[model samples]
Target: MYFRLEDKESYKSQEIGNLIRAYNRSKREEAESEPLNLYVEDEKGNLLAGLIAETFGNWLEIEYLFVKEELRGQGIGSKLLQQAETEAKNRNCRFAFVNTYQFQAPDFYKRHGYKEVFALQDYPYIGQRYYYQKNL
Candidate 1:
């Protein structure tokens, strides 16, 4: 739970959001038949950080990641990610992947040995979108 979200889709934000909600509704419909994990962190008894992962075969998608704004840039994100990667490896994951916006920490992932596999430009804003993966 240490990544940021760049709400793209501009004029389509609301529409895209609706679509996401609908998509999530469908995914939730199968929740009872599938495994779900919610990892979270709290401070002063208040939940502040978390991550959600969906797994299939040997892969996991970081469906959601969040860290309180006041807690950013202090290595918390990196540590959380390290934990996620460790967990992925423990589960026999061959690699880990995440999507990031151009304004996000693409360089941060690079520093942690993740390589960019794809990118789309001018999405949500005037920046490069990124998909990164690191082999376990």
Candidate 2:
């Protein structure tokens, strides 16, 4: 057998993810996972902001939350987060989890009641990575 690193968009990367997901599903028959992606677009259909997440079992795992640089500080991120949390709750999710870097929006998640559960220091040899969670 051989192993090779592949770009994130490659079919091999997708196959690896599918294999892991299949194994996980086989282990947890009750687990129901689904994507919970939200996006904001301009009138011209241009992308502005987005929140990507997934729900499985009783938890919502936030993968990414991004807003245009110019649109930052205008509450677009908060709005997207709030909407995702609401939808997760409606789907019977009991908790939400997210991770952010020191230079990223750690305080934003905290402001939304997500508590820091762990921190990895010296991530990227300069900054920290923070893991946060909130009860829904």
Candidate 3:
């Protein structure tokens, strides 16, 4: 579902705001929560983008991942994904999971040997939501 530009901006900001508030609350609740670990390589020793994973039960979730837009289509996403999967295995997680909205990383995960474990229509917004997993 697409909305007018103004509405889109409003929705985006609202979502981000909620995340910030929740993060702050969690920080106060648990002073020593495990922070996500990220891995990346610098392009010019100054700038870089990477991936992070979070643990929950027997699964490691690919919490966030990015390879600068300019660096897309250059195998960066693949390398980052490979590294994340390796990290998952090292942690003894039986599976790795990630969710993405429509037009997001579902295709990327599929190419990297993950299988679609769940798909929901109109999720988060009016787009499909995909959850993928790879058994380790």
For lDDT, the strongest prediction is 2
TM-score of 1: 0.66
- Model 3 bad stretches (over 4 Å): 1-36, 41-45
lDDT of each: 0.72, 0.95, 0.74
lDDT of 3 by residue, 1-136 (tens): 8764563467778998999989887776432223346656676665467787776555778878887787788887887777666766666667788888778677788888789888998876788988888886
TM-score of 2: 0.85
TM-score of each: 0.66, 0.85, 0.66
Candidate 1 wrongly placed segments (more than 4 Å): 1-40
Residue pairs in steric clash, candidate 3?
Answer: none
Alpha-carbon lDDT of model 1: 0.72
Q: In the order shown, what is each candidate's alpha-carbon RMSD?
A: 9.5, 2.6, 7.5
Which pairs of residues clash in candidate 1, taking residues 3 or more apart in a chain or in different chains? none
Q: Write the per-residue lDDT of candidate 2 for residues 54-112, one digit (tens) a residue.
A: 99889999999999999999999999999999999999999999999989999999999
Worst 10 residues of 2 by lDDT: 3-12
- The count of backbone overlaps in candidate 1 is 0
